[model samples]
Target: MQIQVKDISKIYGTGENRVVALNSAAMTIHEGDFISIMGPSGSGKSTLLHIISGLDAPTSGQVLYGDTDIHKGNDKELSAFRRQKMGFIFQQFNLLPVLSARENILMPLLLDKRQPDETYLREMTGFLGIDTRLTHLPHELSGGQQQRVAIARALIAKPAIIFATSQRAILTAKAAAKW
Candidate 1:
């Protein structure tokens, strides 16, 4: 899938309290592309990702995935689109505390009513170096280990695109190389 991010902007609040998070930002992302948005803190990197990925709406303009304007879709349609076509690795590890690493990794598949492919699951976890920690809960893992689990979870379904914020922040160079 190719992504086109047109002249999108995100504004918060109004009057004196208003903050412009994004302004006329535009870009194009094609399949198999590894693009990174870089800026100092509070420069709308996350905001751009949210708008482009349909997690949040832009104050003006649009984000399109091929011919479909993703932001124009209703909540349910957008949710399904995100689930089936995109993967996300949030800056904060969003692992469920009650679930084991394995369960967290399998959550997306379960949500889609699809069964896990054991071979792919095993290889993915192994590649991310979380295979031995699968049965453990998030709290039982180290910060890096938690990040690895999150990364594995994002990639388990092999979606067409992945949106990640600071995805390598917690990982070492060696660990990131495995990604």
Candidate 2:
């Protein structure tokens, strides 16, 4: 799916403390494109990603996935859209504490009640170099290791798009280039 962003603006607060996080930002995400939005702190990189992915709504303007406006639907529709078509790799490792690395990576398949193709799962895990860490818990892994687990989880679903921070992007790209 191609994502088109038009005049996207994200504003925070009002009255005395208003801030414009993003202003008239525009971009196109082509199918199979590996995009990286880079910036320092408070640069609205996350905000842009959120708006484009329909995870966060822009205060004004439009985000379209193909020909459909991403913010057109209600929350329920949006949630389902994300569940079915999107995968996210957050800067914070949002792994379930109680779940093992394998379980965390498979959470999306579980939530959608789809049995993961075992052969593909094995390939992905090995490709990302997390095959040996599957049995460990998130707490048992280092920060980089946990991040790889999150990457594995995101990639396991084979979604149309995956969003990640810059630091996480490098890690994921390196792991993916392994095979």
| Residue 40 error, candidate 1, Å | 2.7
RMSD for each of the candidates: 5.0, 6.0
Q: Which candidate is the best by TM-score?
A: 1
Candidate 2 C-alpha lDDT tens digits along 1-179? 78889999999999999999999999888998987777776899878887877878999999888888979999888876776678888778899999999999988888778898889889988888889999999999999889989988888878888887656657878999998
Writing each residue's lDDT as its tens digit, candidate 1 over 1-179 gives 78898999899999999999998999989887889888776899888888888878999998889899998879999988888788888778999999999999988899888899999999989988999999999999999999999998888888889988774455666587898
What are the lDDT scores of the predictions, listed in order?
0.89, 0.86
Each prediction's TM-score versus the true structure: 0.86, 0.83
Q: In every candidate, how many clashes are there?
A: 0, 0
After the best TM-score superposition of candidate 2, give how far the Cα of residue 139 lies from its true spot, in angstroms.
Answer: 2.4
TM-score of 2: 0.83
